[model samples]
Target chain A: MYKVKVYVTLRESVLDPQGKAVQQSLSSLGYQGVEDVRIGKYMELQFDDSVTDVEGTVKEVCEKLLSNPVIEDYRYEIEESAKQ
Target chain B: MKFAVIVFPGSNCDVDMYHAVKDELGEQVDLVWHDADNLDQYDGILLPGGFSYGDYLRSGAIAHMSKVMAAVKKAAEAGKPVLGVCNGFQILLESGLLPGAMLRNKNLKFLCRTVELSVVNNETMFTSLYEKGEKINIPIAHGEGNYYCDEETLAKLQANNQIAFTYASDVNGSLSDIAGITNEKGNVLGMMPHPERAVDNLLGSADGLKLFQSIVKHWRDSHVVKA
Candidate 1:
């Protein structure tokens, strides 16, 4: 079995409103010195032993539909896991 | 004169869009669900603004994989017009219907206010009613409305006149202050404002009504014989 972790975020040059909001909240609570916040998303995909070439397939999915390369960036990691 | 509005699980602006088209154009409109498969009957499709699937993961990430998206793609390929607003814009980015993606607002707040938008391009079917550089007021309500694109693509958009609307002020951190864009064919438009909510003056402003009026007039001009 394989576990695929997908991290999705806006491109570095893009502004992140959610992350900035969270930073403001933290600062309001007296946690200072925080700067340059960026927000992202994480998704996990699990596959069984029958699947082949997990890395290539995940990369293709990310490029084709999972992520929009113009405004967002995505990377994936595979891990060995027990079958369901 | 058939129009359809796609409704995801958590779409709050579907009805507003429905009424906007129905009342303004005096046309029949259908509210299609996200799970529906067939989309051959509609002349146009509108993806209204709202927090789809409660914006799980990303604003439009999960909703991109809905069963109805296949139909949406087919319709788009057939040259039918598709308009995506706010959360709908996010879905268009996720579904690859349009370029770029939505980020959180620069202020990180759920901004809900009337904003000034300047029409950068009026060649699209969506913006044909507005003159180029025309300033209009529309309401924006979203947590993630910022738009980003690479420099090359931005240049391409500028060169091709694909940019439709831009914010008049520095409200959101959109690249080049872009608030809306269209596909290469100008049939698919995705923007980060709620035009449906601005259809009536009683609602707030009526500047956005011209957008829907443009679609109706375009359809008539394309199909109806002028005397």
Candidate 2:
């Protein structure tokens, strides 16, 4: 088994609407100095395959389908998990 | 042309896109789920609209990191045409497949209505069917569809004629009233309107079908007949 984590965010230079909305709400609630806010996502996955090639598999998946290299970016680390 | 429609968890328009591609162009089409990684099989990829992941975190932000996105990136890099509609547009922005980002409608309410879009550029794979300066009505359904970008990037996009579609009227306060944009290479396109939903006259208008037809025609014109 392998555990994987996915992180997705807007490109560094892109503006974030949701994040800006939250920042506006925060300021209305008496917070300050929040120059910018960018929204992102995190996902955790557990794969049942225990093949000898783990990292390469994860990387392949990440590069091929797991993350959109355009606006969102993702990286994953794999660790062997005990089989049930 | 062979086509594939990506179906993320909250993708609502994958079937519509599939039918639009198949019924309109009579092309081979497939529904690719978010978990699949291999997309080298298709000639074109369509990221359909919908509230992926229930619009959690942000529109398209969660879906951007899905496994299928990796395949999307590869297909795009290989110069295959990719189209993103509505939430799919947001995903493209979140995924960095296209520049600019989505923001809440300036009115702070979900806007669902027909919108007028002027064809700013007719040279992209997605907009080739429309004549330059032509105006078409397409329905938009989204809470966060306002597009924002820095001035420098916006200027560059404008200079390159990458702005494919612009709102004829101020709809969501998108910067420069941009409704759709194409990548510099014209292989990737993202628009915040639900073109697939408008492909059939039964649904509303058939104007949207022109987009799919354009993509198919371009592929055939470039690869099959030309070759």
TM-score per candidate:
0.88, 0.75
lDDT of 2 by residue, B106-184 (tens): 7768999888889999988887889999988889998888888878889999999999999999998788999999988
Q: Assign candidate 2 its CAPRI class.
A: incorrect
Residue-level lDDT tens digits of model 1 in A1-84:
999999988778766566777888889988898876777878899988787888888988888766767667898889999756
Q: Chain B, TM-score, each prediction?
A: 0.97, 0.97
Over B34-139, each residue of candidate 1 has an lDDT whose tens digit, in order, gives 9899999998999988889998767888888999989999989988889999988899888888877776677667888999999999888888889999999999
Chain A fold similarity by TM-score, each prediction: 0.89, 0.76
lDDT of 2 at B8: 90
Candidate 2 residue runs with Cα over 4 Å from true position: A1-84
CA RMSD (A), model 1: 2.8
For model 1, the docking class works out as: medium
- Give the DockQ (2 decimals) of all models: 0.58, 0.10
